[model samples]
Target: MASKKHNDHYTDYFGITDKKVPFEDLDVHNDTRLFLDPHLVRLRTSPRPYWDQAVKCLDTFLETLTVRVLSRNEDPGDLLKHIQEPPETHLGMARHGYRGHAASDVIAQRIWESLTTDLYSLFRVGLLEHIEDLPLFVRGIDRDITSDITTRVFFDSLAQFTMSCMRQIPELSSRGTIQIEKTVWDPSHKQWAQRTYTVPKNNDGSGIILIPRGWVRKRLLGSASRFLQTETLTYIQHSRAQYDHRGKLVTPSKKTLRKELAKEPHQANIFYTEAAKRNRQNLIAQFWQYVDERYTEKGPNLGDGLARP
Candidate 1:
C-alpha cells in the first residue's frame, strides 16, 4: 500500500506564499500553478551551459551587497539585529542571500539542498521501494482497480513535490509582468537589488496568474518528466507560476492546486481525485498483469505457505 502521506510540508512558512488571490471561478490548468524552489536555484555544475552566467550573477549580486554592508564596520549579529527590526523588514537578509560567514553559507547550502532536491530525491527513492513492494498488497485489491490505484499513487507523490517546489522559488509567479521587489540592500548603490518578474492575467475572472519564462518552463519540467507521467508532470510544471521574483509566492491555480490545498489532506487521497483519473486507469492496467502472473496457479506464491497452518 502507498503510504498515503509524505514527509513534505507546505512552502508558505518558508516565506513563499502567493500575493494575489485568484477568483473563485476561473478554470486554471495544473502546470500554471507551479514555482521553483529558491534553494534549488544555484550556480550550475562545471562545463554546463549556464555555469558562467550563474557564477557571474551570484558573484555580482553578492559582491554588490557585501561591499556596501561592510562599510558599516558593524558586527554581523548587529547587522542581523538592525535589519530584522520592523518597518524596514523589507531590507533584511533572506535565506537566499549571502549572510557574511562561510559557515553560514555552507549551512544554508545544506539546508537549501535538503529541503528542495534532497527531500524529493529521498521521496522518489522511497516511492520506488514502495512500488516494488506493492505486489504484496495487490492480492487484497480488486483485479480491475489495483494498477490504476498504484499509478495514481505514484503520480500524486510527484504532484505533491511539484506543489512544494513551486512554493520555494519566487520567480515563477510573475511570468509575464515585470515587478521588481528589493530583496537585499546594496550599500555601494545606496539602494537594494530587486528581483524582477513578469505576471499575466487570465481572461477568466480568476485574475492575474504567473507563468514561467519560456526557457525555465522548458528546463525544469523536462527534468521532472523523466520520473512522472506526461500530463501529471506537465500539471506540476504549470503549477510553478506561484512564485514571483522576490521569493514571495502567490496562490496556486485552483483546478490543480485544490488537491494539495485540501483540509486534513491524505496525499494518497489524490489517487481518488478526478485529476488523477486517467493516470489511475493506467496504473490499474499495469499492475493487474503483474498480479495475474504472480498469483496464478503456475506462478510463485513465495509467502503463501508461511501464513498457513
Candidate 2:
C-alpha cells in the first residue's frame, strides 16, 4: 500500500500553522516590477529613510580600510622598482610635452599644476577625506604613466576590492553601492554642466553610467536626505555689514533668518550632492591604482576580485 499523505489546508510546524493558499492568491500590481530586486529598487529610489545612516556606514568602512593599508609596514617595493625604469615608447609623447603648453618642461609643470588645482578643488569641497594624493603625485612625477598606474592600483585594491568582497558575505548581501553625480544650476552659463555616476559599479569592469537630468535629480534628493540625517553638525554661515549698521540699531527681520534656515536643507542637499560627485572621481582614481598594482606583481589576476564590493 502506498503511504497516505493528506493534502490538509494547514501544516503544523514551528509556532504557527501554515495555511494552504492558491498560487494566485497574492495580488500583482504595476509597482511589483519596480521592487523585484532590492538593489534595483534602492538604486531607483535611493536616499531612503536609512540612507543617511548608510552613508555613515560607508564612510566608516572606507576609513577603516584606508587606515588598515596605511598602517601596514608592508611596502609595495615593486612599484618603486618599476618607477626606476623609463616608461615604454607609448609614454614618449606624454614625456615630451605632447599634451600641454610651451616647452616640454613647461608643459609638464603646467600639467602637474592643473592636475593639483583640480585635485585641491575637489578636496576643498570635502570630496577627498585624506591628502595621500600629494605623495602619489610626487612619486609619479618623473614617470607619469607608471606612477599614475601604481597609485591607482593601490587605492582600488585596498578599498574597492574589499567593498566588493564584503557585499558577497551573508550579513552584507542586502547592502548596495552608493553613487553620485553633479549638475550646475547657474542660469547665465551657455552650456550647463552635469555628470552622473554609479558607486561601486565603476570599480568593476563597468564604468559609471551617466543618466539623464531626471535621474540625477532623484539621486541628489536621496543623497541629501541621507546627508542631513547623518551629519549632526549643522553647516551655517553669518555675514555682517559695517557701514549699514552704523546708521542705527537696524535689525533684519527674523523671518529672513527663518526662511534662510528653511532653505538650508535644500542648499545643503545641492552642496553635498556635488561633493559626492567629486568623491566619486577620487574613488575612481584609487580604483585605477588597484588595477595597476595587481597587474605589476601578478601579471593579471583577472578573476572575480577585480570588481570592488
**Residue-wise lDDT of candidate 2 within 183-295, one digit each (tens)?**
31111231223434333321122222111111111111112222333221122111132235457534434345345544454344334334446444333244335544543
For model 2, the superposed segments whose C-alpha errors exceed 4 Å read: 1-103, 125-299, 303-309
Best by lDDT: 2
List candidate 1 stretches off by more than 4 Å: 1-39, 43-55, 68-72, 75-198, 202-309
- What TM-score does each of the candidates earn? 0.19, 0.19
Candidate 1 yields a Cα-based lDDT of: 0.27
- Weakest 10 consecutive residues, lDDT, candidate 1? 82-91
